[model samples]
Target chain A: MTNIAEKLNISEKLIATLELEKNSLAGTAHIQAIRKTALGSFTEQGLPHRKNEEYKYSPVSALFKSELCPAKQNACAKLTKSTIAELRIPGLDSHLITVVNGFVSEDLSDYNPNAKSVLVYNTRNTAKHAPALFEKHFGQYASNDADAFIALNTAAFQDVLFIQIADNVQVDKPVVILNVTTTETASLASPRNLIHVGQNASVQIIELYVSIDQNASAINNSVSEIVIETGAKALFYKIQDDCPGLNLITTTQASQKANSHFDTHTVTLSGSWIRNNLNILLEGEHCESHLNGLFILNDSQHVDNHTLVDHAKPHCESNQLYKGLLDDKSSGVFNGKIFVRRDAQKTNAYQSSKNMLLSDDAAINAKPQLEIYADDVKCSHGSSTGQIDEEALFYLKSRGIGSESAKALLMLAFTQDVVNTIRIDALRKHAETLIEKRLSK
Target chain B: MLSIKNLKAGIADKEILKGFNLEVKAGEVHAIMGPNGSGKSTLASVLAGREDYAVTEGAVQFNGKDLLDLSPEDRAREGLFLAFQYPVEIPGVSNINFLKTAIAEIRKYRGLPPMEAKDFLKLVKEKQALVELQVTLANRSVNEGFSGGEKKRNEIFQMAVLEPCLAILDETDSGLDIDALRIVANGVNKLRSENRSFVVITHYQRLLEYIVPDFVHVMYDGKIVKSGPKELALELEAKGYDWIKKELGDVIEA
Candidate 1:
C-alpha cells in the first residue's frame, strides 16, 4: 500500500543488494560470465522511471510496488491439465512448450525426439555448462544501457529457454511457448528467454502470456532476446491476453545479420496495465525487419507499446505498423522510432501508428518518429488518432444497421489491415474471434 | 409530394435562402435554374436536413409530414433523397452495402422486415443495370476512385434502390460529358413515376434538354426572379443569363 515514490526507494535498495550479490559470483570464464555481467548491469540500472526516453508514457514505479519475488523452485508442479486446456490457442496443439511461474514443465512441452536441426535446452543453470556460448551472446543485443526495465529483468533472471537452429535447416512447424503465472498476492515474476538462428536457417516462434487466476494482481516482467545469423530468417509472434487485474511488462530484443530476415507480430487484448518494448537492430547489410502490433482495450485498461528499429548497416529495410482500438475509459499509447545510423545508407524504413477511440472518454497517444543520419535512406513516419467517422456511421446506420452494430462493423473494418498481417491462418482467425468478442462487449 | 413555404435558412448568421417557397406534387418535374450565388444548392441542402444550414423561418412538408423537424437520417427514412453534387467517398464501405443500408433504413421506418440477402443482391443487380452502373463499381468502396460520371450514376442508382417519394438532384450534370449526361438523365427519367416527384437544381439549361422539366424558375441573388414553363429554359439558353439581367434592369427603371 506504499506510494509509488516510497516503493521506488525500496526497489532501489533491493537492486543495490542484488548487484552486490551478483558481483560476488565467481563462475567459469564462459557464457555464464556474460550473463552474470549483464545481470550486474541490470541491478545497477533498476526499473525505468518516467524520464527515460523509451519508457516515457509507460511508468514502471507502480509495477515495483507489488514486491514480486522469483517463482518457487517447484512452481511447475502447480500446472495442471486443466490449466493447459484453458490456455489452448489455435494451432497450439502441435509443438509447444509451457512455462509456468518462470519454470519449464516437461509434461506440458512437446519435444521432437528425432529432430536433428533444432535444439531446445534449459538455460536455467547457465553458470555450469555452455558458459562460453552464453557469455558471448547473452545480453549482447538487449543491453541495459538505455532501458531500466530490461535491466531489471536481467538482474532478476531465473529460468529461461535456449533455442538454436542449425545452418541451412528449415523448421516446418512453428515453436509455441506459453508463459502462465499464478499468484496468491501482489508479487513480481521475471521470465527470460533467448533464441539463436544459425546462418541460412529458417524458423517461426510464438510467445503467449496468460494469468491463471483473475483477481490476483501480479507484475509479470518478461524479456526475450533473439539472434538471426547471416542469411537466416525468423518469424516471431507474441500474444498478450491476460486478465484485467494483471500488470504486464514485456521486452523483446532482436539482432539480424547480413541478408537476414526477422518479422514479429505483437497483439495485446486486455490487461489492467500493460507495457511492451520491442527493439530490432540490423547489424549487417541487406537485413530486413518488420514489426506489427494490434491492441483492443476497454474499461479502465491501459496498454502501451514502444518499438525501435535500428539500421546500422547499409541497404537494410524495416517496416512497422501498430493499430489500437480503445473503448470506454481505456487508454492506449504507441511510440515507434526508427534510427538510421550515419553509415546505414539506402535504408528503407517506414513506420505508421493508427488508432480509433470508440468512446468519448477513451484516449490514445501516438508518436511515430524517425532519426536519419544518412540522407540517401527512404525513411518516413506517420501517426493518426481519431474517432470513427460520423458520416460513415450515418452511412451505415441508414442501411438498417443499428447504431451499435454499425459501430462494431466500422471498427472491425478499421482493424482489418493489422489483423490480416498475421501469417498463420489459424492464429489470424483466433485473433479475429478475440477482436469480435472484445468489440461486442 | 414535397412543399416548402417561406423557408428562410442560412449558415451561422448569414441568411442565404430568404423566404423561399416551392412545391412539387407527385409525378411532376420542377427545375430551379439560377445564376451564380442563387441559393439553389442551399434550398436542396435545407430540404435534405443538413445540420449546418439553419432554417430560421418556415416549414418543409414531405409526404404530409413536417420534414424540417426530423433528423437527416429520419428524413431519408421518410422517403426523401438528395443526390449531392459532390458525393462523399467513403473508403471502405461498398456501394452495394450503402444502398442496402439505405433501403433497409427506409423499410425499417415503415415497420418492414429486413430484406433477405439473396433478394437484396438481386435488387442491387437490377438497380445497377437501370443506371448502367458497372458491376465492379458497385462492389468497390462507395464513390472511392470513381470518375465524376460514375459518382453521379452511383447516386441515381441509390435513388432507384431507395425509391424515395421526393428526389432532389443537386447540380447532377455539372461535370458530365454529353454521353454521361444522357446516361444520367435517362436514369432519372426512368425513375420518374406517379408516386414520386423530382426537383432538379442546375446552373445551365443543358440537362433539361434530356429530362425535360414541367416548370422552370430562374433564381438570382438568392431569390427566384423569373418563373415560366419549359420554353423559358429554351429562351434563356438562346440568350444567356445577361438577357435576364437586362430585363431586371428595365423593370427597376420603370
Candidate 2:
C-alpha cells in the first residue's frame, strides 16, 4: 500500500493482506502486467469514502476498514458433492456452474464442457488455457481507475469464471453461474467473471448469489465484464437472495456493438448490505437496451443500486425502471445516469424510479441524472416514493380481503411492471415466487 | 337487517353527519336522496368502516352484531357492501383474481370450504351476464380504465356474486348517462330479493324511475328532514328540494 492512499482510510490490515496476495498470485506475464497496473491503481486510490458521490448512500468500505478482506479466504471444508448437494437451487433448467466461495467447484456443478457453442473456463486455468482471449477482454470495460474496489478486485483473485460464446451459434440453454459462499468465519469473496459473445450469437446468463448458512458472516466484492458483438442478443439476470450475514458489492459492466439487443433484470431479494453498480455502453448504432430492477427489503438490510446507460452511438434506445419495496427499518437507494453522446442523435431514453416505504422509519433515495449532447433526442425521467396506497388497501379490504393479503396484493402489484419485463417464463415465475415469499412474510 | 342510530361521523375535525338515523328492513330498498355535501357519502364510508371517518356518536348494527367493532373486511364478511361513487382503480391486480380472493376469504370466514373452480367460473359468468359486463372487462385489472357506467355495473356485479345483505350505493348515479343509469339500475334490480336490502343513495330521482324504492328520505345538513313513500321522490323532483329545506329550515332553527 502506498503512503498517500493510507490517508484515504484504507485499513493497514487490508493493505498487508493485499500485498501478501499480490506476491502469492500466479498468472501469465501479460496477465501479471494487468494485475500490476491494477495494483498500482489500487495503491494510489484506496477504498471510497462518504465524499465520493457514488458511495454516498452506502459506506461499503467500512466493512474493510477494520478486518482483512475475505475474498481470497473462506474455503469451506467437507464441501464434497454430497455435502454441497443441499446447496443447489432446484428447478432451473440451465447449464449450471457452481462457485463455492471463490473457487469453481466442478464436483458441485452440472454443465456440458464439450459443447461447441461455448467455451467455459475457471479463473485459475484461464491464464494458461485461453491466454489470448483472456488478455484481450478481461479488465477492458470495468476499468479500475476510479473505483477502488474494482482496482483491488482486478488485482486479487483465486478464480475467474470465463465464458465465451462462439460466432453464429445460438446456445441451447442459459448459462447459470451460481455463487454459493460457505465459510466458518467472516470471510470475504471476490469473484471476477468475464463473458464475451461473438458476432450473430445469442445467449442468456443468470448469476445467482446464495449463502448456505444464513448466519455466516461474509462480504462479496464481485465484478463481471460482458462484451457483445454485432447483431448479437443477450439476456442477463442477477438475482441476490443471500443470507443476512452476507454483505455484497457487485459490479456488472457490459458494452454492446451495432444492432445488438441487451436486456438485464436485477432482482435483489435478501441481503445484509448490497451495492450493485451496473453499467452498459451502447458502443455501436441501432443498439437497444432495457434495464429493469426490483428489490424487496426488510429488517435493517440496505441495498444501493447504481446504473449507467451510455449511448455512444446513434439510433440507440434505452429504458430503465427500478422499483423498491422497503419495510421495517430497511433502506434503499437508486441512482440512474444516462449519457447520450454528441453524435448519438435519435436516441430515446426513459427512466423511472418508484419506491414504497412500508414503515415510517424506512427510507429511500432515488436520483435520475441525464446528460445529452445531442440535439434531436427524446429523454424523460420521473420518480415516486410513498407508502402503500391506503385507498387501494381499503378498497381491497372492503372486498373481504384481509389487511395483510391486501397489502401483499398491492405490493405485488407495485412490482408487477418491472417483474413482467423478464422474458423467460420460468425465471419470471421464480422471481414472482421469491417476491411472494417475502411479501407473505 | 341494518340499523344506524344517531350516527354522527366526520373526517378529520369537522363532523359531517350531525345526527343521522335510518333503518332498512329486509325485502326493502331505501333511497337516500340529498344534495351535495349533505353527509350521504360520510354515512356510506362510516358504514363500510373506512378509517378516515370517525363515528363519534353512533351505533351501527348489522345482522344483530355491533358493526362498528368489526373491521372493514369483517364488515364485508358480515354482508355489507359499498359501491363507491368514485370507484378506485387498482392496477396490476386482475379483476377476476381480486374477486376470487374476495370470495375465497369471505367463504373461509363463513366456515365454508374453497369454491370449486367450475362453480366460481359459472358464478362469474352469471354475474357478468346480469350486469352486461364483458368477460374481458371482468378479467382485467379491478376497475382499471373502466368507464363510469362500467364501474357502477361492476359494483352491482360484485354485489350479486357476494350476495351482500345490506348494500350501500353512495352516489352510484352521479356521473352516469341515461343508458348507463338504466343498465346499472337493471343490475341492482335483478340482485334485490326478500333476504337482501339496499341503501340506494342518489342525488337524482331519474334513477328511481327504473328501480322504485320502498322508502324515500331527504337528507339536509346531515339529518334526515323528511321521510315518505316512493312518490316523495317524484314530488321532490317536481318541486325542488327548496320547498322541504324551507319548511325544515324553521324546524332546524327552532
Candidate 3:
C-alpha cells in the first residue's frame, strides 16, 4: 500500500488491493525476487494514459477507476464440471484445460501427467517443482519495461500456466485452454501463461475467454509468451465471447527460431471493451508468420487490435489481414506495424485492413506502419473503410431477398477471406455461425 | 399483360425516358431496337423499379395492377425480372445459394411453403442444362471472375430458375460474341411459353435471328417512333439506324 500510495491518480487504489494479497502469497526466494522487481517497475511507471503510443486508442487508465478487488479463487462457486461442459465447442475433440478465476482446475483439465514428452504445470507450483525452468523463461519475452499492464500482471498475478513439449514430438490433438471469470462483485483477474514448443515439434492451441455470470462486472488482463524452436510449427487461436460487463486486454508475445512457422487467428465476437496486442519476432532466418483477425461488434462495444512482426533475420516472410464489421454505435481500431532490420534482406511482408460500418453512428480508425532498413525487401499495405456496396445490395434485393438477409450475405462474404485463413474446421465453422447469428439480428 | 403510357423517367434533374408508350400481350416477344442513349435501357430500369430513376409522369400496368406502387423486391415477387446489361459480380455469395433464397422469399410472398432441398437441387440441374451452365460455375460466387459469355448465360439461367412472367432483357447482347449470343438466345427461346412475355432490348439484330420476335419497335429520343413486324429489325440492321434518324429529322429532339 505504501509503495502504490506514492504513485499518481487511478493506479493508487489498484496497488493498495495488491499489497493486501502480497502478504498471503507463498513462493520461494527466487520467485519473490522476481515479483519485487516487477512491483518496482510498476511503481516507476504507473497505468498508461492516452499519451502513450500503444494505449492511444484504448482507455486503459479509466478502467482502474472502478471500485475493484483481485479475483478470489473461491469466487467461482456458481460453476461446476457440468456447467462448463456445455460451453465447449460442440463436436470438437481436444485436450481441455479450464482455469477458473486464474486458478488452474485439475479436476476439469484432461491432462495426463504420466504421459511422457508433454507437461503442464501451474506457475504457483512451478516455483517449487521445476524452479530452473520457471526461472529461465518466466519473464524472458514479455518485457516489464515495454508496458504497464505487463508489469502489473507480473506483480499481482495469482496463478500462471506453463506448457512444454519435448523435442521432435508432435501432439495429435490440440490443447484447449478455457479461461472463465465468475465473481459476485467487481473483480479483476490476471492470468499469465508460457508455452514452449521444442525443435521439430508441432502443436495447436486455442484460448477462449468466457464469463459465467452475465451480470458480473470484471476485467481480465492476460499475457502469454510463446517460444517456437527451430523447425517447429504452431497454430494459436484466440476467441473472445464474454459478457457485456467485462473489459479485457490480452497481450501475446512470441519469438521464433530458424525455419519455424507460426500462425494466430483472433476472433472477437462480443465484449464491452477489448484491446489485443500481438507481437512476434522472427529471430532466425527463414521463419514465417501469419496474423489474421475478425471482429463483429454491435451495441456500444469497442475493440482495438494492434499487431507487430519484427524481422530480425534475413529471409523472413509475414502476412496480416484484419477485418471489422461494426453496427449501431460500436467502434473499432486496427494498427499494424512491421519492422525489417538492416541485415534482414529478402523479407516479404503484406498487410491489409478492411472495415464495414453498418450504421453512420459507427466508426473505425486504421493505421498501418512499416519501417524497413534493408535494401532488398518487398512490403505493401492497403486499407479500406466504407459502408456495404449499395449496388450489390440492390442486386440481391432484385432477386427477392430481403434487405436484412442481403446485408448479412454481403457481410459474410466480406469476412470470408479472414475465415478461410483458419485451419481448424470446427472452429472456423463455429466462428461463421456466430457471425451469421450476430448479423441476422 | 404489360402496358406503359406517357412514361417519363430520369435520374436526378435530367429526364431520359420522355413520353414513352408501349404495350405487349401474353405469348409474344417484342424487340426494341435503337441506337445508344435512346432510353431503351432507361425503360428497362424504370420497369424493374430502380430507385435511382424517378418516374415523374405516366403510369405502368402489369396484370391490371399499378406496377409503380411496389418495391424492387415486391416487383420481383410479382413475376417481374430484369437481366442486367452489366451483370454485378458479388463475391462470396454462391450463385446456387442466391437462387435458392430468392425462390424461397418469392414463394413466401405468394403464401406458399418453401421447396424441399431435393426438389430444389433437381430444378437447379434442369435449369443449368438449358443455359449450358457448368456445375462448378453455378456453385461459385455470383458472376465473380466470370467471362462475358458465362455472365450472359448466367443471367438467362437465373431467369429460367425464377420463371418470371414478364422478363426484361436489357442489352443482353452488348458484350457477347456470336457463340455466346446464340447460347443466350437459345436459353431465352427455351423458356418461352404461352402465358409468359419478354421485352428484349438490343442494338443489333443478330440476337433476334436465333429467337425471332413477334413485334419490333424503333425507339429514338425516349419515344417509340415506329412499330411493325419482326422484319423491321432486319431492315434497321441492314440499313443501320441512320435511315430512321434521317427520316425523323427535326421530328425527334436530341
Best by lDDT: 3
lDDT of 1: 0.80
Q: Write the per-residue lDDT of candidate 2 for residues A307-409, one digit (tens) a residue.
A: 9999999999999999999999999999999999999999999999999999998999999999999999999999999999999999999989999999999
Off by over 4 Å in 1: A1-5, A12-39, A71-94, A105-138, A296-299, A325-330, A355-365, A386-410, A436-441, B96-111, B135-139, B220-228, B242-254
DockQ score of each predicted structure, in the order shown: 0.24, 0.89, 0.79
- Runs of candidate 2 with Cα error greater than 4 angstroms are A1-10, A69-90, A214-217, B135-139, B250-254
Tens-place lDDT digits, model 2, residues B142-195: 889888788888888888899998899988888889888888899999888999
Off by over 4 Å in 3: A1-8, A214-217, B250-254
RMSD of 1: 4.1
DockQ of 2: 0.89
Local accuracy of candidate 3 as per-residue lDDT tens digits, B111-229: 99999999998998898899998848555899999998899889899999999999999989988988888889989999999999999999989888988999999999899988899
Error of 3 at A171 (Å): 1.3
The order by descending DockQ is 2, 3, 1
lDDT of 1 by residue, B1-254 (tens): 78888889999999999888887899999999988787999898888766678888988888899988887778777877888887877775667656666677677779999899999988878888988988485557888899999989988988888888788999999999999999999999999888888999998899999999999999876667898999999999899988998999999998
**By lDDT: ranked, best first:** 3, 2, 1
* Total clashes for model 1: 8
Better of 1 and 2 by DockQ: 2
- Model 2: lDDT of residue A360: 91
- Candidate 3 CAPRI-style tier: medium
Give every collision pair in model 3.
Answer: none
In order, what lDDT does every prediction score? Answer: 0.80, 0.85, 0.87
